[model samples]
Target: MVLCHDEIDAVNDMQNLVAAPSLRVTTVQQSSHTTLLLCSAYNFYPQQIQMTWLQNGEEVTSDVISTDVLSDGNIYYQIHSYLEHKPKPGEQISCMVEHVSLSEPLVQVWDPHPPRPLTERVKIAVGTFFLVVGLTALVVGIIKNKKRTAALCTVMHENLVAAPSLRVTTVQQSSHTTLLLCSAYNFYPQQIQMTWLQNGEEVTSDVISTDVLSDGNMYYQIHSYLEHKPKPGEQISCMVEHVSLSEPLVQVWVYFHCFDTGGVLLRVNIGALYLQSKVYRIGQLYMISKHSHEQSERGEGVEVVQNEPFEDPEHGEGQFTEKRIYLNNKLPSWARAVVPRIFYVTEKAWNYYPYTITEYTCSFLPKFSIHIETKYEDNKGTNDHIFGSEPREEETEVCVVDIAYDEVPERHYKESEDLRHFKSKKTERGLLPEGWMDTQDPIMCSYKLVTVKFEVWGLQTRVEQFVHKVIRDVLLLGHRQAFAWIDEWIDMTMEEVREYERATQEATNQKIGSFPPAISITETALPINVRNGPNSAPSTPLSTEAPDFLSVPKERPRKKSAPETLTLPDPGRRDSIFKLPSFFSWNSSPQPE
Candidate 1:
């Protein structure tokens, strides 16, 4: 039975309701002149709290900064308050807190807690616990369906704490020799074994094993090395054994041997759906290795030109920003001739791409300022009223093919309304006072996924835009189809791509359903057809040159270049295979032994 609010609060009061926030005051030596005191209160519940500072028993106000109450969603909140002062000898400083459930504000005098322990000393337990849990669940459910439960348990074990995932990295050391390197991490239960296996048998000699390394998260991983020049048609594998699995985990690496195809350059345009309420700004481009798991990736955050000044969008309309980035190492000149470029204009969120959100890459919020003052129209005469100056030719991005725009409605409950409604129930029970309610705000959540599909040369390119905030947006994270298309684009030619794109374009047209193509094309000079406004050219891609086919290059190659962005597979520096949520497993099952 559900307990009444008064009954729950009464029970909570007897149990002290929530833990009083524990306070720690630490000092950071900013310089020879002043020291900064950090006041942190954590492990508290029912977040309504007031923390204050005092210098020598008098309430201190200036130079004080406190974080907003941050909730862990279990009715618990963690917060920090900071103060900066010149440490005058014999001046006592302290931090005080008042909670709804506390009788007296617990005062903690200034005592510096020891510096946070370095990560190297912490021992973490990895997949071992979850694997055992799954095994237990499998046993408990065995009577219901033994085969299916065991299979599910095995899959869980593989996903939770599979043996150290082995990544085989090979670079052509020379025309005659290659550096065959195998790196593994994201594992658990430290007693892991790694070895090089050729064909099917283990190769003991000519192998190097490093001591197990700690990520300090309780997970241990180590790298095993083998340096050798290979014979043709030979199969190599990095096999690992750990306690998480029913059997050893093996990752077989077939050499990208005797390359018949030219080296490829991949360009990705990076932007987030959350940036819709802004002026049209250019996106970032990065030079990444097209081959999966290549080391040495770097971001080149080059800003492309902006378009004509526009006004705020009308209701039910959205603003779309197009960013084109190149993904590949510098290619041989011949590779440029047949560069298999991929363009996706679907409205997927930023978190979907693995390589996009890494620490070494640009992960946090979008770059441009939050400015929304643009309204675009197609008639040439309308520009004088919108822009103080005439629009420049360089700012225009000519889509030399058919264009189509569609709106996908993403329906979600208005979150603020949900939260407010929840708070009102508590307020009625005298939990939170009536002052927290704002009766004026209108509740809304109906949003549209703005999409634009067009062809660039023969590539079926689409651009999708939808606004999102953190937690709600994270639920929409998806990338399989997009990345797969990215991979497939590596093997395509312009003419062949166009043929395939024609089919997909036709399919999309069918889905538009009774709506005439939002875009129309005609063979005319300098005439722009923009049913939607605020469109412009993309910034120059880092690696691939414009094909000189459909679209014109946005800019000439810059003389000065941003240094190369490298991909670090070092476990200490990456999320690796464990980037998935705790229980989600990738379909990376090892081949049967």
Candidate 2:
């Protein structure tokens, strides 16, 4: 039978197989003295299956135990083995069963009571204690971490530590707007502010917007719209103000474009001012501008006038075109004063007008005279009233008037032939005379008419006229010396012309002599004449003459043996008609004596 229960109370439980000779047992609810066991006995094919208890080698069987064959086709036999009294320490109590198929019976025995409850209770207690300690430590650790985080936040707030960094994000330019996206970092849980400053002044409104994060950090996106072009020197600064930092952090960026001035940009030297495109004297700054009247006016008005006309209106910027002048070390005060102003055209172009004045002293001339005489004779001279006088005394007198002129002589007149004669005469005389006498001679009185002319030059007319009349009367007196003075002036001028020509010729010759000749020394040294002939070999001497040794006479005659000596006629004793052979004859041999 199957048994179902919520719980089982047992010290031990045993079940035995009838045909298979196996047994299973369970022990429960037995604290002492009770044991559950199984036993089996085996004989032959018809082996008897039975259980028996042995106590002290004696079999004890009880009726309270039940035995049967299991449904699994195994032989089982069971019998409870109990000691009538508690089992003695040395006694053996066992359950034994016999099976028909085995030679011996199987037996199992155990004490039903055990101390397992005390061991299990101790294990459960230890596990529960460890679990409680682990949970408590985890809770304490979590609380400490929370406190530390709170302290760190407090310290960071006190120190005002904020992360300051900048990065240029997206830059967008639309039709009229410029947008910038930026993120800012600062210590959280505090009040911090950001602002934009344009050239040191705060800009609060008209900037786009700001966004704050859950952690008290902020993201700012700004759009700045421009309605007009920005002026030069205008600047924009991103100014951030926060409680986390002591001072506001400002980043400023300036915008400007290069400009060209349409003026002479001079390379300025040391100790000089570059004005009007030229380096000018420091002292002459005013005078350089003064040369241009328009520039002078502009310089005077520049200080007083707030809005001045642009020097070059077309170019928008006030560009002054420059001019250069090389300065002299020494300059007059007026020139120095005016140079600086006139050096450049401040208003307009400068007009330069130079004025000059000259003085001349009057020269005085002394008195001078000229005289002229005319002689006319006719065949009826005694009856002519024009020459009324005795026949021999009859004469015609003509006084030639001398025009006296005083003033500067005309330029053409001074360059004319007459002035050349006058100047030449003055050089010869060294000085003008106080007065002069003129005379004219009457010739050919038989039938001739003679006329004489005289002229007197002077610085003043009255003196010259008085002198002329005197000269006229002198000439009318038939004086012959007046013509000589006139001829001297003419001759002196001709000599001057000749001298000038000669000097010119001498100068030309000197210039010519200074130059080297065209013919060079190297060319002159070269041989002009070249010989043309077949190259001849040097001549050899003729052998027709005697050997040189024989040509020379010896001082002494050669010695000879006494027997070989031959007597010869002495030239001194021989007759005059016979000629002796020379001592150095060609056929002669030395005599042996």
- Judging by TM-score against the true structure, name the best candidate: 1
All candidates' TM-scores?
Answer: 0.25, 0.16
lDDT (Cα, tens digit) per residue for candidate 2, span 1-593: 32223113321232222244554333422226533233332212222446556566555422122223212112222222212224457665656666655567666654444345657778899989999999999999889777655544423334444544432122212112222323354334335455666677876544432233223122222222211223444655566666556787654432212111111011101110111111111112222222222111212211100111122212222211111111212223543553453221111111110100111111110111111111223221122223222322111111111211111223212222221123234324212121111111212121111111111121122222222223222222111111112333233332343333234323333332332222111111122133111122111111123333432134432211010001111112111110111110010000111
Candidate 2 regions with alpha-carbon error over 4 angstroms: 1-160, 167-170, 186-190, 214-231, 256-593
Residue-level lDDT tens digits of model 1 in 499-566: 34334333333332333223221222121364232223122111222334544233421111110111
Q: Where does candidate 1 have its weakest 10-residue lDDT segment? A: 398-407
* Poorly placed runs, candidate 1 (over 4 Å): 1-16, 28-36, 46-99, 102-593
lDDT score for candidate 2 against the true structure: 0.27
Candidate 2 residue 231 Cα shift, in angstroms, is: 4.2
Report every candidate's CA lDDT: 0.36, 0.27
Question: Candidate 2 at residue 186, lDDT?
Answer: 37
Indicate the residue-level lDDT of 428 in model 2.
Answer: 45
